[model samples]
Target: MKTLVMFGSKSDANIYEPLKSRLLNEGHEVDFRMISVHRSPELLERELAKVDAQVVIAGAGLAAHLPGVIAAKLLIPVIGIPCAAAVGGLDAYFAISQMPFGIPVLATAPDAYGSAVDLLSRWGRLDLQYTFDSFNIVMERHKRGLPHFQMLLTRAQAIVDRTKIEMKISDRPVENALNICLVDINEQDPEAPMPYGPAARGSDEIRIFVPALSEQAYREAYAGVAVIRRVATVPGGIWTGINNVGNAMLAALQLANAQGAHAAFLTNAKKGYIHA
Candidate 1:
């Protein structure tokens, strides 16, 4: 898996490099860059398109807005790591938390702790399910679910009609992920960035991070593993995902940003206080 690590200029390399090294050991290719959201807004904006990262962990100290603008692009997930040197991590937290709705980013503590591996592991699960779903459906019709399809599908159809929104149709991602016994079914996205709305069965992993969601809303959407599926685009949209478990943690950070959590809280670092 590939991850892009973006850090603020003011942040100490002592803290930043260690985090990058951790990801490297975990068998991931990380793009470590020292461009701050506040210092180099122009260059910062450009990298969003350039870096095709599965996950982005953006770190900063003091009043850092690096993760905010990056998440605003509404592309991949942006994780903010608040440095301890900045107001005990408060400055980083507030800056990230104040993001307008619909923008999602993730965060981690300055020391980052054991989160690097924890985050990427989730992405790996998504990739696993994606692979299985594709094979079960396309290769063998009966391989995905309980024996004999016609009767099972009919019953599933009835369930959808009774509750509204497709439930467990054979073609539905929900069924593929569920019947296939996927662990993190919700992590998958309904529609991948592709030519169509959803992809072929099990084309890619979908990681969803939804906050303040109703039971009904969550159930109907994310019913499949297709790379392209239209499941009602909510304001927060789906939190971007990676192909494995570790990156999922990265997605979690960005999703927290969407829910208005501060980036500082993500880290155990400190920030400076305002002066007269």
Candidate 2:
């Protein structure tokens, strides 16, 4: 598989270098470039217009719009890495993860080689089985704290009940199971050994983080789950407020099923709720 790796600034080399090297070592072609969306919008547009690659990986910090801009122009999947340049990288994380509807970018942690490789594996470029094998052992030893947010729990449960998908709320992940894990960032302790225990267990599981008001909590959780199978955020970001647990659950369900179902689900969900 051929990949085009782009970053906004040369300072982001530490984040994207390992990723590029790993891709090359795995016998995949990589085209690396430094193109800032804000500074060189015209050049970025021109380059993306004729770029020949199956996937595009773009990294940037502080208002990280490189990946979104690439995604807006390309038909291929764009994986975004939010470097920790400002505000513990939460600003870049939100900017990349919370992209508007229709332009989808797979936002990931600063060290996101595993997610990128996993995505390529899913696309038939590599035969790697799983990336979080070590995480499983750690997750098995530690116990997850009981959920603290009752209101969010009730909302998530209602979403699962309505969808008729079997919901299991546990600290550890089930091996080889096709499940969507709903994690409430607001209920986690920053000092906990493994705050993202459930999400670390397997590559088949999808994790949806419920919105939280604390910037510290968000930063810690995003760093904790460095290489989960997939990560998703609430639809409207902060505008959805802290009570968008239901939206997170819906996102989980949407990811759990076929991609074709997303449009229909969004249409229905937007009728009364989810302005985004």
Candidate 3:
């Protein structure tokens, strides 16, 4: 509920104002201050001890060590927002990002305030969260023939569409279009009857790349839906199948990024694909 935001210089106030306003709007206590690590180390330390907060976000430019220093002193989570003060902020970003073990600083670009907000929102689970396992679990759940898989597909479509528009992608489908492949459960297990048929359930709105064998059947089965006969394998087992999907999503995201598209790619695990 309480957040302590420290900016290294008064000149960086413009960068801090929006984040401060966002936290205030969310009805959280935001203590904003300008404390330089180099100029006023003692004052910064004294003020840090005085402040009581659930999370601390520090902004610094040019060899930014404020967030790392804050993390070194406090047990609470520290998020670093690298300012574009020197070398377009790359120097500051590396400063906080390359913290030694036992001291962890969450690094983000100065413009990515939303990333900080998201971290703060889920600050309580920061310590307990296993990021790799979390991603694997998402894939595992999808393999059980659950609805989350369909949800992920829908979210991926939205991301692709938004990115296309933002990047001025042509309406005509080209070789460069982000290809989204869907697993053919029936093909993988011919004996087992697929409840949703060729494609997964609730996947009516999005484009799905199907295996060559079941391409015609899926097209006939689901009218008005886009289905492609692309080279995609649907290996047996829940984990293997899910890994295939994750790989496909990652490929699509990479293509989108390569095309200079505006994509949030991994906004949330339950909602969209996480770029892990």
Candidate 4:
């Protein structure tokens, strides 16, 4: 199947390119166009008429009416990708999603290329679903405010040990090995040897300290500990501490999964952090 990717400005290339690459990887012929609804309406119409595609992925920022306009003119499946260029893309999202009754522009998140591909797959054209090596294991430390310290510690340890044993049996090299990161919600006591557990110090483990949402909280909780600001490169095969651990497990898991980690264990609770 062929897919057409249309965007309002050249800056939208960042969003368009990735989707185009993914579509091409899924064995679909993709054509990209940098045209606008306001500026080049005639040219856009002419180009749209000429393209031979089964699906159209249109994106726009600010008002973000490009997708709606495309959907109005064309009969093919139009998937709208809102660009986060203005007002955190919410303006674009509303404009794309809240369309008139007759015209339907299927809208999704700003960077939701997989959803776009899934739309195609449902149409019985292409079969493309992206998956990473990192498997997520969610551990709830608390529902409202009940501390499950031992439970968190126990589950974390089990996952770590099991991963290590499996890796050892597989005999994968250190460079090509898997890793685990601790997304601990509120394990207080900075003096504790290993916050998550002793296994956290293992070569393949990363400790994610998501205690506080702000720098002030982090400084108060982790006084002497070296809390990573944004990102850090570990040269000595060490786990770096990332502070945004509340709902940032996905980001951490992406890193671990990129390195071929088999599973990512996360806690699904909103309890207070463990403090002294």
Candidate 5:
């Protein structure tokens, strides 16, 4: 049976390329699309209406309203994938299953291509007893998917070819931070050796400013701390008020402008030092 795997962008393809190949060998046709139903509803609906695939896997990240839209428009079985990230794929997952009434979009998990295949098997897409062998091969390969099967390198690389991060800080300690969060702090002991610095080493309502969003890099700021807290802000609110990390660093600069902070220092992620 032919199956279509539509996505919103090329990155979405990167998200599930391996899985698509897996489904292909199962004697199921796989299709991909980058059409935006919201942008071109008539065209999208027209194309989707023609597919009689046994199962359709739609992938999207961030505002992942694409999959649910496909499911709502048809009665055919749909498999949804929610691309998880550092924070969470909550929005993406919700977008697929949060149907108004009768519309339904079945999903597995973060990178649950196995679930999609499993669901198709239950639907009797392929003979289970004899065919599980082929599926087993796929599973074997996946167990060793990458070199380090145990570790998943989700640490988003420092955006390659990214320019330096320049930001302003009222104090020198923050001069080193661009896009940062206090993930942990040591349990303070009254007798613990205290490093000399600003009178109040740890203070509430810390302000971070950037010359531009480009300087805002993602990283855990604090370490060995108790009662870790995160400030309420949008995904890319630290850099910009928009969405995603693309223009986040640039947005950070705008925020700095609003707060009247001067670009006093720049860092390139190698050595935590200041330059004139």
Candidate 6:
């Protein structure tokens, strides 16, 4: 498999080098480059036009536009790793995760190269693989009816009401149905368990995380899931500037719907006052 790894600045070597090495070790044809979407737009466009890779992994920070720009130019899957350049990397995370409805840039936690690799593996582009035995155990406990699970369902219900998306909560993945699971990471416990069983069970299931103030929740969730498969982190910080619940929910809906369904969905969402 061929993989292209790009970053905004050469100083980001510390972030992208290990991922490149890991791809090489996994017997992938790795093409590493330093192309800034802002500083070198023309060059970036030129490179992307001729690029021949199964997937692209881009890392950037502080209004990270590299991944989104690449995704716009390429039809292949583009995974974004938001670097810790500003505001605990929340700015970059939102910039990547909150892309427009049609163009999707799979956003992961800061420096989350493992998640990128795992996504590639799941796509059958790599030989490496992972098992979800522990994740399944955690989900089993949630199935037995945990307090937190109830809380998550309540929150999900609220989100459903607001977004008006036809979705349901299920222990197993349901075909033609939007399967979603909500996990709250707003607690102070750093060692808290993040049960991402729905994500592990199906690639189509969307996992939404309400991150804590310290942003440790994002790290923990990314570490547990370790893949880009339909995962999202809602807008969160000390001030909570914007409510991105609608965006995340719409994104999930778009992913669930057919390919050309984005335009209609985006139009209806706008009419319904939902930010898409």
lDDT tens readout by residue for model 4, 214-237: 334444534323222111112121
- Per-model lDDT: 0.44, 0.54, 0.48, 0.48, 0.41, 0.54
Q: Regarding lDDT, does 4 or 5 come out ahead?
A: 4
C-alpha RMSD for every candidate: 16.4, 8.4, 18.8, 14.9, 22.9, 9.1
lDDT of 1: 0.44
* Per-residue alpha-carbon lDDT of candidate 1 for residues 117-197, written as tens digits (9 for 90 to 100): 344544454443223222111112333343223322343343234324333223333321212111212335543332212
Clashes of 2: 0
Q: Which stretches of candidate 1 lie over 4 Å from their true place?
A: 128-276
Candidate 1 clash figure, as a count: 56
**How well does each candidate superpose onto the true structure, as a TM-score?**
0.48, 0.56, 0.47, 0.45, 0.44, 0.57
For model 2, state the Cα shift of residue 89 in Å: 1.8
**Cα lDDT tens digits for candidate 3, 51-111:** 7776788888887889878877765557788787865665665576555433446556444
Runs in model 2 deviating more than 4 A are 111-114, 122-180, 187-276
Q: Considering summed lDDT, which 10 consecutive residues are worst modelled in model 5?
A: 131-140
Alpha-carbon shift of residue 96 in model 2 (angstroms): 1.2
Superposition error at 175 for model 6 (Å): 13
TM-score, predicted candidate 1 vs. hidden true structure: 0.48
Give the distance in Å from residue 34's predicted Cα in candidate 6 to where it truly belongs.
1.0
